[model samples]
Target: MNNNTQTRTYAYVAAVLYAAIIGLSFLFVKMTVSVAHPIDVLAHRFALSLLVVSIPVIFGWIKIKLTLRDLWRIIPLGLLSPVLFFAFQAFGLVSSNSSEAGIIQAMAPVFTLVLASIFLKERTSIMQKLFLLLSVAGVVFIFLMKGSGMSAGNFKGIALLLLSTVCFAGYGVLARPLAQKYKPMELTWVTLMVGFVVFNAASLIRHVSNGTMMDYVKPLGDASYLGALAYLAILSTMFSTLLASYALTHLEASKMSVFSNLSTLISIAGGAWILHEPVHGYHFIGALLIIAGVLGTNMSGRKRGLVIPDKA
Candidate 1:
């Protein structure tokens, strides 16, 4: 294969790994959140991710090529994700249940699609829209199958969750040009650093004000929490995002965002396998939709032919 083809293949692989890592991360999030506050969990997760990213830089292994100007450019991208995305999500989940959150979060791909088009001038083919819609539909179907629909009383949480999705979509769209300009590791480092400082500061401020600084360190005493942190910080926060940066460098933001829904499918299967959660036939059907959607979206038949609405 040519260099372009080879790199695209790697990007595809990286996207899949990103999806798997994030898919499994929900389990760890469940584990840690049960034992600790969400902000504290996020703080520790990024602290560790930042530490891991720092080690390579400290040892002169990974040279950071970022300038002050680049930092200024990318700071918002970092905040858009680990900062705003997680913050909004952490708070959004307070009143909203998982089912409600899942349904709303499914809008992320659509948000990314629109934002990429408007800001980045990224265009999609008719086939891409169909598959992207299919993938999103898969997620909504699963959440709706869980029995609770969007509650009017959860409007606050729902709005916050929608903002979180926008932040996440913003990250995806904003990273495209930046990814073309910078290496993935450089972007990843800045992202981790931003998340570390922002989340830790928020967590610490909350704990200190409550005279509960001790609560922050208490969760680490559990070995299970430690394990959860390892997976979350090292793999999910640092590596998966690195993979995302690399993928976004090679693939269009619209195509790359579609892969995020694969995590939903993986989450369901992982829950069944590890958490012993029951899976119904709908789960299988939804998984099929997600898998087929991802495949169809990425296989590259996207041409600017006659346009069709996503639903017909």
Candidate 2:
């Protein structure tokens, strides 16, 4: 096959990998955060990610030529993702339920679609738009079927969650060009470095102020916590970011964003298999909707006989 087709195929695979990693991350996050503060968990996760990515470069097995100027350009992408996205999500879930967070996150495609159109100059056919909405509707239906837990009248929580989606969307849009410009690992390295520095500094500040510096490393003593932290750092944060960057190199931001809905289905499956959560009838139905919507969104609208690319 041709290079473009080959690249496109790899892009979709990367998108799927990113989605699956992110989908399973909720499970891992639960494992890590149970024994440590959320901030501390984030700190450890990024610290590990940065260390892992930096090793290849330090060992002369990989090469990167990032200057201060490159960091300035890439910093916005970093801010949009691991830093702001996680912060809003951690705090947002504090006041809202999983169902609510699910519904809010499903709108990430809509956010990317709009941002890509305005900022990235990407276009979509009418059918693609409908399919996108259908996918979103599936996610909403699944979450709404989840029913009310504690009502969230807390405007703060809702706002933060919305901001989280926006940041992710913005990252997808902004990263598309940068992904094409830099090697995937280069972008992933910067992202991890920024997250590592920001989160660790924040954790350090919190510890200093509260005289809880001793408690920071206290979580590392647990074997389970260490396992969970490793998964999050190595797979979720580092590998997922690399996959996303690689996909963005060949896919449009708008197309890449829709794959996020697949994660909802993955999350459900993970819960059922690992957490022993019951798989309700609604889940099967919602899963069908999600799968159809994703397929349709990708397959239905092709101006030049090509579906757009999108992801987490």
Candidate 3:
């Protein structure tokens, strides 16, 4: 295959994998936070992720050449994602249900599209914009049909989650240019390292102040907790971020953001099969809309003969 074709293939695969990882991540996050504080869980997740990614670099299996200027530029990108994005999300979930959070997250594509158009000069067709809205509407439809009651207290959570979406959308837009300059592994490693330092420091201060420094090790005793943490650290954080970074290298930020909607369908199916959550009529309807929107948004690429170069 030609270089552009190969790049597109990789981008599609990365998008799919990133969506799947994120879809199932909710389960692991629930299991983790049940036993540990959210910040502590996030600290451990990134700390371990840093070690996992570092092995290859330490052993010279993956070589990365980056200058001080490059590192400075990349730091803000990391701050946008694993730091600010996750902090908002973690705190947001404290007050909001998964359904509500998922609905708000569906708006990320819109934020991403606007940011891309302004910063990257990327443009989308009217049809693509409609399909993006359709995908978000599908999520809202499912939650509304489920009759999930909301309280005034949830407004705080909703606002925080929306902020998280904006952060992630910004990350997507910012990462695109950097992707052209850095390897995916290099970018992922740096982001994970930044998260590791920030979260661990925050977690340390919280524990020490609360006199829970010794209690911090208590969660490590549970095998189930360890298993959940492992998944979050490996598949959800490291692997998914790597895939997203790689995909952003080949896909427009708007396109990559839409793929996040697929996670709603995956989450629905996963809940039914794994969590034994009941499947409802609204679930099927919402899934169909999400699938249709995803296809409609992506179909434009084929008609327009969209191709990304292998190199900047």
Best by lDDT: 3
2-38: candidate 2 lDDT, tens digit per residue: 8777878998899988888877776566556568888
**Cα lDDT tens digits for candidate 3, 1-95:** 98777778889899989988887776567667778888988898998899999999999999988888989999999999899988887778777
Q: State the lDDT at 35 in candidate 3.
A: 88
lDDT of 3: 0.84
List candidate 2 segments past 4 Å from native: 94-103, 152-159, 305-312
Candidates in order have lDDT scores of 0.81, 0.82, 0.84
Better of 1 and 3 by TM-score: 3
Pairs in steric clash, model 3: none
How far off is residue 285 in model 2, in Å? 1.0
* Stronger candidate by lDDT (1 vs 2): 2
True-vs-predicted CA distance for residue 250, candidate 3, Å = 0.6
Superposed by TM-score, candidate 3 places the C-alpha of residue 142 at a distance from the truth, in angstroms, of 1.1
Displacement of the residue 2 alpha carbon in candidate 3, Å: 3.2
Candidate 3 Cα misplacement greater than 4 A, ranges: 301-312
Candidate 1 local lDDT, 77-125, one digit each (tens): 9989889987787667666644345446657889998998899877777
